[model samples]
Target: MTNAHDHRADLTASFEPMRHFMILQSESDVRVLIRRLLLSCLLIALIAQLVQSQDSEINEIQVGDYVRFELRGNTYQGPVIQATTNGRLLIVDVSVDDRKSRRQVKREACVRLTPAEMNSVFKPVPPASKSEPIELTMPTLAEPGEGEEIALTNEQLPSVDVSSPTVLDWSGFQAGKRRINKVPFDADPDLPYVLDISTGTVVYSVASDHSTDIFVSTDRPSDYRLVRIKNHTVRIADTLPQHGVALGLIRDETDHDKGLCVITGLSTGQPRVASAWSLPKQKVRPLYCHYRRLLPDGSVVCVYENTLRVFDGRDGRLCWHCPVPAFFEPAVSQGGRWLAIAANGRLFVVEASTGRCAGSIPNLGKETMQPCFSPDGKMLAVYGENRMVITRINDGRVVLDHQANVDLAPFGGESLWTAPAVLVTPGGYLMDLRKNMLVWKYQLPADVNEWMGAPESGWIPIINDDWLSFVRIPHQDVTQLSAAVDQNALVAIQAGDSLRIEVEIKDDVRGDVDAFKANLTKALESSGYRQDISAEALLKAEVVRAAERTDHYINFGTGKTESITYRPFGARVTVVHRGEELWSANQAGNLNYHIAGGLQRAAKQLEQPPANLFQTMQLPRRFLSKKFQNGLGKSSVSIDGVK
Candidate 1:
């Protein structure tokens, strides 16, 4: 180990992948970046003492520094890989054969490598091919554990027999954009609140430059009145973006003064009390955001950075606090008993009162978005780009899993005493979850581009620049649809055609079925494929590997040898049309996350095949194929095969 002054200039050659390095204090208060070219920053923290494998300390080391750490009475040294954001976690690749094969340990378990150990190493894993089989013993993959990273619902709920629900044809629902009320845009108009929900009526401050306005859920929103209250002449800055309406407005009828629940504080300010305020009082504040919901007890739970805090609704006093990594905004249950948050690309449930982490959901993809709790707080719906999920809270069981559709919004769920009869299906469905089917459905009006439900009022609101309109919908017209994967793709067919494309997941070698689906869909869409088709054509495409078998094997010579030799671990792509297959092919090696990376490689090959393989396949570098061309040379066919 050497001082920072003696750091080698050639270190960047071996650690270019790690962009750069930053030296942050133990607490990571602030970072001092030391650039290693234009590389990714590796946060380095010099810990005081070394501990077990789970946690350790490291030297004032740089890239290419061989470091050792003690765990369970044994010491293991490996070249330093890289440090994470806060320098609290260090990712070390123990096996040279597998770049993805690494482990995360604390900074305390790290020490510098000896000169002798650094010089003594074996050969790296070589690429594998059918021409030369490297026969060697390898450990079989372990069975997936009881703990799956992403375990959403595996099957649909028991089919419920729901009655036909009243349907509002998009046409019958006259839609227009109109401003309900016009005022000099209230306080801080530029920083609009993320959402505003009304059971029907809402309370707004009038433009007396000193008064407020109101419209109760039972009254029309256009009707406005003024009320007197204190005002604050302060310009506070915003801290968080507004999102997640699951945690609706915090309203208190108790104060009678039409009290609106909120949290105050901008950048430097801390969220003190959580309640409504006039000029002297404040409504929900940006310092505490992502999502905020009111409890029956007049308390409000708000997300402020990495912590979830409950503020007393009456006076906005802080109550219990739950600590979780700051992530996409957090949502509180309508009942206020459970809290839903996303961190590290997974959904985590928290016990609001105890701040105890209940369970973390895995494999909903590597990135998760706004997660909403059902009104009853028993089931939850999580959103993602490629997949959408609804799971139960008690065991974190998935209630529904489907291809992700940004249009579908998770609004509300059935209450304990009520029938499961309401849901918001953006595809124009008045579905009955109890019946597990659509009672009535309609399509969006051609004129309306996007539709968003009002926080509470049965009104579906729309706005175009200066205009806004409240499209009224009857409560009976609202129906809750059962959670299911919306794997709907626009089929290209004629008036008399039908279509079906089989979804085959050969081992999900990539581990992520959603990502695979997304990739395939993207390739298909980009290839001009997802257009409407007729009922007579059979369009079947199989998503399988190129080789259909393992091209990788590993060998560990003996306990005396520290190296493991294996070939490249990669992914292959094969798109089959009907039982008839199209002759076209593949190529993984020197990698980990075999399936994920393989999928990427396969997709790339599909888009732009290697020149040599392109010669053998005989297809002019095309990603997808269309069946049954019309008189105009257009793909017009009916598909029904390979489900």
Candidate 2:
């Protein structure tokens, strides 16, 4: 646990959360705790702020009661009044202290307090009620200790009509804000991120303490802390400089290759680079150490502009240097056995072991771009503006020369080579470099917003506004392409008096059952679900499995070994309509399915059903675009060509 790299192994011990409430420092502290409590209760939501109180007395807030509540960030007090329409929850005609008139507020955000917090100096103005308004009563319950966690029982939950408008609101809440953000920090999502590939932890540069800091988040992004600061532009290599050591190349703003580099331990954050060499005068442009490859004999190859420099993997020492004429990025074989260089219009094949040219493919085109090696390293795929050509690396032979859509871009938005010889373009087939055949392809419908293949691998990551989806490649036919493959289908019904969540975790599995239940309850309630002890139906969820997989990688530049723990779980929720089986859906398992997030999603899905054609059009593309974008490339990976 002392080693930062090894600390990842005992994640449960390292999972310490930040304090919820901020300590307020006031000059004249009369009610510092009171001010902090009021300020810290505020939370942000996309559509509307659903004000939730830590007080248990919220359950006792009834119709005709005058209560003070927070809305957005402001506080309001008013009488609970019926909604303007039928089948809607009670709304409040709140009289804000500053406002001369009244403002209507949803009763969901109302807060209730125990008798201990009641002030004898205050008096109830009026209560909204039916035939007769009841008198307000105070001093009902005793004061609770600060920071006390109030656990709600089934008896404390209030029941409301299932058809209430609160549950039927059309506001589509952005759910991703509540989930783990997978995008890179301090860089565009589509850009090739600076990663410690050994550990796959993306590096970030954030301004802190009047300096640019370099660090990686422990688990989630919010859990990030200060690691080290870099006053200048820094470059981190793909592999370790030493066991649990991270090596970063640093240079001044002049873009000189003569600047020195440093090796920092991942565990201790101590400088491991003992000697600072006065570098030789060479390439002037700032070098970004990319395409790092570790060879068989503890040697490493890294590419920067037109230069491929091999260095000792164990220690920072130059081994060999190869020149890449014309400076187009060359494609190397997976294990660094062969390298494909596209110089001018011809593609030259070179032996990586001896840096000797073997063969050449003459006259690819006047404009050839994005040359990539196949998975087996036997073939190379070159992407052009409208054509993709796959050639064998051993001998100069064109395996497949196919016309691509003007919109096809491989790596990102442009028609780039997805893998060695494999290319995916919009409205075209997914060409496989290995077999010189189309594995699968699709033509997106007119209404479809955006699309693209993620990488050379067969899977594609799709994001539509706040929604995210993934699908496997090689859909050769229409049935396979357009088939309804709903991995995130949630069917929430007007469920029972209570949600009975049964968690069945394996003996070795570790999770927080209480936290899981509470989160699920919150999700269900947000989705228009009301607890009714008298209801005949019950929504029963059984977590059939709770499993986790831990992966170990090089402990960044710190000697501390780091590991990633993935919680892959599955559960099933059944709607029991008067003891008859109504419907059931099984939760799929993946890295995305955290117990709390799954429940929140299911609840949200139930609250917001599948949008019809007309409904989806009105939905906001806040993630992809704020307003209507007439641009051709709207999605992350534009098959129609990345911009």
Predicted candidate 1 versus true structure: per-residue lDDT over 73-139, tens digit per residue = 1343333344333333334443232222122233233443342332232111111111221121111
Model 1, global lDDT: 0.33
Determine which window of 10 residues in candidate 2 has minimal summed lDDT. 613-622
Q: What is the lDDT of residue 513 in candidate 1?
A: 45
Question: When superposed on Cα atoms, how far off is each prediction in RMSD?
Answer: 30.4, 31.3
TM-score of each: 0.36, 0.35
What is candidate 2's lDDT per residue for 188-292, written digit by digit as tens?
A: 121112122222233333332223344442223243223444344444433221122333444455643333333333322222332122223256655544345
Clashes of each: 78, 32
- Report the Cα lDDT for residue 148, model 2: 16
617: Cα error in model 1, Å: 27
